[model samples]
Structure formats: C-alpha cells, structure tokens
Target chain A: MAEERQQGHKWTMIVDLDKCTGCQACVVACHAENNVPSPSEDEIIRGRANHWIRIERYWEGEYPNVKARFLPVFCQQCGNAPCEPVCPVYASYHSVEENLNVQVYNRCVGTRYCGNNCPYRVRIFNFWAPHFDPPLEQQLNPDVTVRGPGVMEKCTFCIQRIRRAREQANVEGRPLEDGEVQPACVQSCPTDALIFGDKWDENSRVAKMIPHERQFKLLEHLGTEPAVYYLKGGETHVGE
Target chain B: MRRLASLSLRQRLILGVAVVGAGALLVALLAIVIAQTSAADEQPLAFSHKTHAQNGIQCQFCHTGVAKGPVAGIPSVEKCMGCHTYIATDSPEIQKLQGYWERQEPIPWKRVNIQPSYVYFNHSSHVAAGVSCGSCHGAVAEMTVAKPVVEMNMGFCLDCHAEQENKDALWDCTVCHR
Candidate 1:
C-alpha cells in the first residue's frame, strides 16, 4: 500500500538565510501550536531542551571581524531518512501522501534508535511527562496531541494545519491553492524568511525560488534529499 | 472411558476445574462483546433519536460540527431549551433539560461513541466523501437512544477505506495518526 502513492503534494519549505534575523519566533510558534512542553533550565543545561526547531548560531572570521550566522534547523523531512530504517517499531516512516517523514507517537516505544540515527539531530525524546500550568492548558490546540512521556517527536511541518487545509479543499471539490498550507514556522516568520508551498505546483513561491543561484540545501553532500531548501546569504555563503 | 479411569482422582479433579474455568472465560468474553455492541449508556436526559428523527430534526441539527470539523459535538442545553421552551415542556426528559438550563449548567451527556486521542478521525472529511452518518454510526434514525451498534476499531475503518477509489492515499499512517 505504501508503494501505491506516486503523485501528491510535495510540501516544501524554502528558508532564505539572508532574510532571517534569528528572532526565534518560529520556535515559540511551534511550541504554542504543537503543545510542546517547555524544558527546564536543568534540561537546557544538560542539552536536553525540547525544541522542535532551533536557530544554530555560528561565528565566522577572527577577533573584531567576526560575523554571526544563524541557520534555523529542524527535521529536513528526508526522502531517504536515516531515522526511518533504524526504528525497530515503524514509528518513523515516510508519508508518501504528503511527501513528509511521519513519527507515529502511538507506535513509538522510546527506542531512541531513530534519534541516534537521525543525521539532522532533529528527533527529540520525551524525557519527562508533559505538563501545562492552569491558563496555558486552556490554550492547548485541540488539533494537535499533547504527547505523553516515552515517545519520540519532531517537527511535522504542522501536519494538523495541512490536514485541515486539505480537508477543506477536498470538501470544496478543488485542489489546494499555492501557499494555502503554512506550517507554524512559515506562518510566524516575521521577515518572510520561511516560504512553504507544494513544490508540485509549478507557480508556487517555493518552485520559483528553487531556480535561484543562492539556493542550496543543508548538508547536500550526504544526499538526504530534504524537502527544505536554503537560500544563501548575500555577503558570504553562510548557509552554503 | 479407559483413559479417564487410568487418571488419579486428583488429576481428574484438576482437569475438570480447568475445563469449567475456560468455559466461564469464553462466556465472559462473549458477554463483553454483546455489551459493547448493544448497550445504550444512560444519558442525563433520555434524548430520543427516534423522536427527533420522526419530528424531522436532522442529525446535523444537534451534531452541528459533524459537517464542519473533527468532532460531532453534543448539543448544548441551550439548543434543547430552544425547542423544549414550547414543545414537550411537561415531559420528564424535557424537564430534566429545563432544570439544567434554568441553573445555567450544561447537561452531562454520556458519550455513546468514542475514539482514542491517537486516532485522529475527522467527521467533516468523512461527511464530505458522500458517506452517510449511518455507515459508521449505525441506524441512529431508527434507534430510540443511540447505541454503538458498530465497533469502530482499526479494522472497521480499514474495511471501508480499502474499498475507496483513493485507497492508496487513505492507507497512509499519517492520514489518521499524526
């Protein structure tokens, strides 16, 4: 049944590194939208912070001539995901319908094998039981699950929103329009750095952006074939 | 008879007990299946589906969210008061609804059908796909109080979904599970 899907939406995201201010708006939006429990100070200190998406800061040049480069990294949604095969349980697998990597929380057994195998280090393990204080509990999105402890979770590109848009389009008896589906990161991007759309649509912003000279992917040499593309910064090839 | 006679009294007694225990377990299992398929959970007010259907009240009139979202939401006491304010005001069931409405409280309606949180079933998509409510929900129009005539396990979903034209897309894990 998995082999049957040959044509469908190839949801893609184009991140222009030049436009990004590294404000962490996407990170905050992801937590709010997905009901991700905030990590403690100790967890952060232990490098166990549960961030679905994070800005990776790098320093270039020496002394006074140093430049700070920010690259927002998350699940690349690899076509040939390393994490997929390593899973004893089929928790991590490619969704042929949406052309995205899916992590089924219910199927996950906390093996952490997927986490270990993931080249992007995007997969996060739930170390403790999830908690939400009073008013914050009221704001939890009914569309997304509040995952329990002992499950693996990563960026889903806000699939709940994708499902919503798809269902709406299906009900209307029409195809999904370009830029109709937006992940939380793309939606909250203040600088419009993150552009998301179905790459299969010839006129989509992502499709148009694909041909640009500045376009590249993170760790392209490894051949993960990620759905995400990165447009290099103007001054220096920081993303490259 | 020869084999039975060869066994000691203690061995025979143990074997007989085991047989009876297994029989009891099988009966218990059958009883559970029967209960799940036919038992109508007692609701706060005996809201009769047959009564409403006969009166030409559409199922979607109360289950407003069925065609719009994931949940087929329970009707609020205010919705009941909208009609019971004039009609059936004296009926005990309607009076129970009136009491809840008078106190500005919601009627605690026990869910007749339930799906786990992991299984992300969307009602709008199913409704849009030309599926009748009775397909999965059974014959609610003919029922007095709605009972789960169908067990909505994974097999129940896959059986119907497999027959669809877009079965390939429907078979994806992320379609129902996030």
Candidate 2:
C-alpha cells in the first residue's frame, strides 16, 4: 500500500531571511542530519566544504549605507531542475509522491556534469573517502548513510527521517500529523526562519506562508520553479 | 605374479603420500573453524548483563544517546564512575575501570555489534518506535558477554521491517542508503 497519499501534496519550504540571524544552526543541523561528510581543514580553506544548505553572505551599498544580506541556498528541487537533465545516470530525479528531488547515492557514478550545470553551486563532490576522527565517528546519525569518494551528494530534505515518521504513524493506524516529520534544519532553527511542510494542503503552514507579500524564489526569471521560497527584506533599516 | 606386483612400487608410494596429505588438510580445517567460533564467544572482561539489568540500571544507562540522538553510545569510564565509585570498590573489575578514569582514558570496549559502512541504522528511530534493546541485541540481561545473535545483514533488516506491515519502511532503497 502506498499509504493513503496526502492527495495533491507538494512539499515546500519558505525561508524568511529577514528573520534569519545567519547563526548557521540550520547549516550545522543539516550536516548532522543528512550525514554529509565533514571536509578536512585544507578543504575548508579551499572553499570546498560540503554544505547542503549555506547562508550566502552578500554586501550591498557603500560604508554608511552598507548592509549585509544572507541567503540560505540549497538544492531548489526545481520543477525544471538544471541538474536533473544533465545527469548521465538517473541519479537525480524528482519524486512524484512529495514533489521532492531525491538523490540516490548508489545509482550515482562520479559525473561532474550535474555539479557544473547547477546555477547556485550547491552540489559538492567527494574527492576522498570521508573520515571521522575516532569517537567522533560514533556521533554520526545512523539514519543517514555516510557517502564515499567519487559520488555527488546534495540535499534530500532529510527524507530518511520523513520516511521513518510516516511509517511509524501508518503502523499505528493513524494519519500523518502536522509537525510530525520536520527536517533537521527546521527543527534546529532558533529564530524559526525555515518552515517546511506539504505545499498542496491548503491548511498546511507552507501552503499558507507561500502567498505572503514578501515571498520570492531565487532566480525566478529563469523559471526553475524551486520548491523553496524566500521573503524579501523589509525597508525598516533601508536608510540607517 | 611376484614380478608384476614389484613393477608398480612407484604407484603405491604416490597413493600413500596423497592419503596422508588429505588427512592433514582435514585436521587443519577443523581446527581453524573451532578457533574462529570460540573467539566470537570470548569476552574481553567478565561482564554480567543479568546483574546490571536486575539492579535497575536502564539499558540507556550504559548505552547512552538512544533517545535524543542517532548513536546509542557505549558508556565512557566517567559515566561508570558516577555510581561504581561506591558500588564495587573492592572488585578487580572496578579497580580497572577506576584506573582508566583516573588517567582520563576512555575504555576501549570492543564492539560486538557492527554493520557495513553503507548501511545506516539509527538507534533513536528504533527506540522511538518501541523496539526494545533486547529485540536485536538478544537477551543481554541474561548473558555475561555480548555476542551477535542476529546477523546484521541487509536481508535481516528488511525481514524485520517487512513484519511491521508498513510499506513506507519496507522497500525504500534510500531508507538505509544516502
């Protein structure tokens, strides 16, 4: 049984960067939750750190009028995903069930085509076998697989946890409840900047939030139709 | 008849040598199997699972992190000393534990349960789903040492999930893979 499909459910997230403190909690939480390999010190220095969701810092205006804007960017799971078509193997594909982009590691062969084709530069390649120092290795989340070298990996919206939560509810003979299966980034966000849920359900938070006046998608002109939405910054501090 | 039998002396020697070699090989194989099986059961130190369980020490006491995190971590020496400092001061085992704690060195407990690197098994999810530690670990409360009772194979895991009657958990390749 496919488990009564939450009919017309399209998962989505709306990140309000104005509320985002740029604390990087979502980034760290994503790393721990997804089991993304930690790059070595040298890799960090080379700007090769594997961050599925990163807060991109941008400087605007001159000194007195200067302001910093941080945007958290990850796999948009675009309806017309640029990364999907370039993949030689069908490693990257959009799921019909949740309208989520799923990255299957086993199916992936080391093709850099997807990485080069991505506009946001979110996709990262594994150059060497990921190693965790001794006891630190024990800290890895058993729910997520530790990827090895020569494979490409990006965000999966913490699909493993979602599957677990849904299965547990089904086994108990109940419907999937709201706030039951939250992505690690959503759970760990101290400022509550990230909201995730089924976009198709009119009652869902994500569905309700998407229509806000400030909402906009990254590179909307390209018509990528990313599931993720962002709220533009307000004019409260525009001149100060 | 005597001439004919004496002419095949080389054949008799070859047959005799082949029989001896086969016998030796059989003995070696038997010894190797016995040694390997015995090693699996041997404990690094005497540990009574029965006593700990009976004393009301929850499985999470020693195997921490089963609730809020992925790993059900093995207890560090300091965690043991939190109670053992007064509980078993005279025992040689306690003395060893204390020595390690004094030096601030964690005890290198040999892991009895191991899965392949490709697979991801979260203790928190299982524990949250009401799966007892005993379900997979066996009757740890009755044993003196931990031995793997269930083979931690992909098929073994799939079989357990299948019994749950939840298709959501059963067939997803990404459930265990990244």
TM-score of each: 0.88, 0.62
Q: Provide all candidates' interface root-mean-square deviations.
A: 1.0, 4.8
TM-scores of chain A across the candidates, in order, are 0.94, 0.91
Candidate 1 CAPRI-style tier? medium
Model 1 achieves a DockQ score of 0.56
lDDT per residue, candidate 1, A60-168, as tens digits? 8999999888999999998888899999989998998999999999899999999998888999999888887778888998888788999999999999999989988
Model 1 per-residue lDDT tens digits across residues B36-117: 6455566677888998999999999998999988888988878888888999888987888888888999877777887888
CA lDDT scores, all candidates in order: 0.88, 0.78
In model 1, pairs of residues that clash are none
Clashing pairs in 2: none
Worst 10 residues of 2 chain B by lDDT: B165-174
Q: Candidate 1 regions off by >4 Å?
A: A1-5, A234-240, B1-40
